[model samples]
Target: MQNKNHELHVICVNLLATLWDYNRVGKDAEDGDIEEIISMASKSDLADQEKQVQENIHSQITNFCTFMDQILLPESKSHETTSQKHSTAPRPSGLSLAIGRNAPPDTKFEIPETKPLTFAESCQRIKDLMGYTLELKPSQIPHEQAGQGLFVDGEADVGSVIALYPGVIYSPAYYRYIPGYPRVDSQNPYLITRYDGTVINGQPWGTGGETREPWAHSNVYRPNPSEPPSETGSDRVWKMLSKPLEGSRLGFNGEVLERRNPLALGHFANHPAMVMEPNVMVCPYDFPLNEKGMRAYIPNVVFGGVEEVKMKRFGSFWFKSRGESNDGQMTGPVMKSLALVATRLICNEEVYLNYRLSNSKRRPSWYTPVDEDEDRRRWS
Candidate 1:
């Protein structure tokens, strides 16, 4: 009976964490909301509920919660006391479906540092935390390109999710505020590049105003001027080059970049040399548009027989375009995370990414243009 109770407790904790991870429950979930979830889990029998709940949903929720508890929560707790003292007191709940107040003062979203791990170990750790199976490995490039790069250990079809670029996500404002210029600029003082090469930086800012010094390891994409233009788009290149460097262009918002960590393997992916085709692309993870919609996605949280769950889990598991709508407004929900996805069939060898596009004048040559149908097929 004691063991059973413990199992139930773990299950309940996981369910709650999954809800939070998928944004079904806000990070600043009220004690009452958590109690309600606990009550529901405790009163219900897994055997009885198993028939109604989808197996994938159950597994995903359990894995997500476990990752949070084992990895994120410990780091959060370290600063919890200080944050709690500085945070505003929790407000009363009115039984409405609104999001709760701001997360606890100490609810810093910083990715905790881990001991240095080898490329293989880093990949395994990422897989463990994210519940995704990855087969890529870090290998050295030969000759002039003598540097570490990620290679596919097995065959992967086009549009498959290759890997995730794990690092601290920073908003444009926060990135700019980081003390000192980017490593590239510091090394070559004459050349300074902005994030994403646009007139305005579009990366999302980190919460709580926690800042770190900018270093070479920071994940920034800057174009190399010495590289020749792609043969396919010579005309377009000429047109772009002829135009003045200064002009207003569409810039992305909720855009984010991962600050590479020395211990992360994803950071080793090298930029494409010259105009070679790339196998991987970086994409943003989407978040719900509103609190009500977010809450509706939580599993098993029915209200008066109205089931509101939409997705099995929350993540950038799907590809969404950052394009503008007909009215020139940004479409889709605000993005929160970034992912590295396969653009073409990747074989057992080193993978390359076209990290060009420091300026928005011209699109990078290696970009695998995906239509709505392609996007659907990739995620489906």
Candidate 2:
């Protein structure tokens, strides 16, 4: 139940994050603003909201678990006593019984070398043939304990298609090996080589790969971790477009891109201009401030980091399944939902909210007494 709620909160945040990216329009923002918005919406500010959502989700999940427990209480109690023994009938397998992998051959699948067929094409061919042969979709194997026999309907040629393919199978890891790939770890659900030259469960013979690759994660997609920052095209754009909001003295000078001379990792970590501030890991509601106070200040602090922008953007899409189930499955939608919800309560009423101050019908911001306790500040 706890796990279920955590999953729900993650799904909710993913939904909001997806919405944020999808809603982006107007002219391209200055890099700093883009980074700031991305970071705040996806990572920094939402961290607090995610925490609160997780708590709520957990509470709901606990209630659900409790309800389920109550419903099954009579059956459980009866199982312990001889007077009212529950009938011990065979349990019905949900979906797994239809298609499964049981005692599959020591299968050696060799690739036909003319050209490598993609994993999808191979799977599709198998599906097309299944019309004549007796077999079920791979997903059903989970509910059926019958194992690999699920692929066979009293005797059908399942191995014929699998044998024509290369040892390489598509799983999360194999995606990296594809041309123009990003930060995929080598060890993964797919195997580069078939272990022991045989197939098991109609997938592969080998043990699962060693990589800690999270599916649909942005960190693993753009800005491949193995590549240097200088070589990254996206990083170049991130740097060039980064600047102060478009009307202040700093904004006009393009000084936000100015790097400090002496710092080794550029000026961000060590420069006098880049002050070191504590980063709170929790989400908005979990933090000390109320929603209005948090909304007003968090946007500024969250958008502060240029590098963090991509992570926030990527995280929005990282966790999702495709098609009808795709709704709110990604982080983008999740952040957008939060932003939309907060917008009503915290009015950012400046006419120039989306524009540079010089271009807007608005008064210049004045330096006033800062709400020291309410605002959260951080340095990149």
Candidate 3:
């Protein structure tokens, strides 16, 4: 139940984060101002009536989580999720190159002598905390290219945070520097975008994790020099754009983060089939960097590095399935990442998420729109 409430708080955090941007349409904002515009609606500065509105939003999210719990609790008992046989052995930890193989010049963040948390250890902690475990193996999605999939190895109740999407986070300001800019989706399909335009590339934090050492994230997605160049308008725009400098002045060496969170394989979950309803939904989570106790579990690193930005201004609503700016384009102190939350009781079965691929782009043959209206709203 504690885990459920934490998940509920995250959902509301996102819904309210966009409240500040709901109004006040104007010209583009400067670096600092751009970050502020997406922040949480200020409570201290609000008028009495506005304060009441803020309070009202809090109540609604709480009530919604409670309502869903009431409805899903009974259904959980009748149907168990055993569609395919799971690999009973613990999955392998994500591969990691030996420490110091490619050490950066900036020695600010040191290489610790102690080994970081292991995949099996992280999985044990999650099960102890949430009463469920997860698995990853060949997916049985009936497609020729089902690749890999995330599975709930134990019973998971509704509103539980099932998996976390890990890797370096790119804020709106840093879009130009993404491994493949104008065509950010060019080579990798693990990228997910927040409504505020923050993008997280999950390709770096693949499968599960083995270490908390500074895993180089942004370094993994560099454009392949050998690939044939294309004449597409997207390619031309990117090639013509002046490249912005990377790295952080705020003391961060750049996109190296702890890739040791075992549940960070949220990227492995596949889009649901045409006949299936998604069992899990994407929820935006703002991991507070200062919280030492829970810090290790939150595995993400800021890209360019951001200046001071208020944390409250950039949280989510309780219902979200979905951040800010800077001079060189960096994220706020809060590392924003996506997490998959179970919408229904799940047993030993594959987790399905609505990919919500944009209609503006060409989609795969197996792809079907989960909600046409949602795709329009997102890409438009």
Candidate 4:
């Protein structure tokens, strides 16, 4: 009975987390208006249309709640004479999990001390190593009268601090890996690079994206700051290049599986400056989720940093694209939401794991799907 209860709790948490992830991306303020307008367009009467849509949405919610109630109920029956059957359980729909908020903050905020490095030195180091600039965003630089113009107290190395938080301090590294000839290899380059982020041979690997495989000779170690530059480097070069780079021409090739319009109506009503931009790169391959049929396509937190950009893109009066490719042909929306979702999901998982480890819980169940084994079995 206890084991079944524990399973129920686990399943509920996983389902809730999955739904939350979808709502974060799919549910926009504009959805209500869109639904209303669509209903009005379809029906002659405004009140009747509104009521119909409301009823439809309500039915969907009620069905979900009923499913949850059934799943969470214990299966075992008590034989005691005085025992009574379980009463109807009131199911919670779309309840937010605020469990970790009350936990006391961890005190292990002690960052390591290193040799002093100036801003210029840091910029030079990144340029020399990765052939790119490390210009700090305005927010990252220390302001006058703010802690004596230092980013933090007792921080001697500016370079190290910036590197420690590159995503926050500077724009993240964005490179365009042009799909190579014979198409499939170039399009699916990322698949070769990312890891599943599982530990093997006592080493950690597999989180998906840019960490999967290696260059033929240098496949042993993932690229890191300490590693030397590859002589036979990938054609996926830095965005900032000296010459007219080979992969500069933007390409769009992929299929759109799903889409959600942004909420704000007047976002791009008369904005003439908005143009349909080409994709940064073209992949000749489909995302893994397409093959696996996973509804939990990508996690939200992975690409949370780009939340502002994504929101603006969706909210603005413009048509965003989703795409897929086959037979070396790219089709569908010019841009892929899956890529964005993938990035966010990956980042979110990393953040969750890091936070859990910092909080003294070595294993954060958030990243590990509770029903993963069951899912595999069912699929198989």
Clashes of each: 5, 42, 17, 26
Kindly report which residue stretches of model 1 are placed more than 4 angstroms away from their true locations once superposed.
Answer: 1-140, 143-145, 182-265, 274-276, 287-335, 357-380
Error of 3 at 182 (Å): 2.2
Name the better of 2 and 4 by lDDT.
2
In model 3, the Cα lDDT at residue 37 comes to 53
Of the two candidates 2 and 4, the one with more favorable TM-score, higher being better, is 4
The count of residue-pair clashes in candidate 4 stands at 26
Best model per lDDT: 3
Q: Deviation in angstroms for 110 in model 1?
A: 14
Best by TM-score: 3
Q: Model 1, range 289-377, lDDT digits (tens) per residue? A: 23221121121111111112122111312111334445765443332333345555566767675444333244434333333343233
Q: Rank by TM-score, descending?
A: 3, 1, 4, 2
Q: Please give the TM-score that candidate 4 achieves against the real structure.
A: 0.17
Worst 10 residues of 4 by lDDT: 161-170
Give the range where candidate 3 is weakest over 10 consecutive residues by summed lDDT. 313-322
Model 2 per-residue lDDT tens digits across residues 1-380: 22433443454465444333433532354667656655665664456655545454333223322332222224544223221221332222111111113212232222111213332332344334332111222322122321221122222121111011111112221222222344222332221211111111112212112121111111222224565546467644444333221121110000001011000010011101112121101111111111221111111111111111121113212211224433534232111111111111111111001101122223223211122222211100
Where does model 2 exceed 4 Å of error? 1-44, 75-171, 174-380
Can you write out model 3's per-residue Cα lDDT over 340-372, one digit (the tens) per residue?
766666988999988878677789877878777
In order, candidate lDDTs are 0.34, 0.23, 0.54, 0.21
Off by over 4 Å in 3: 1-104, 108-118, 221-258, 306-332, 377-380
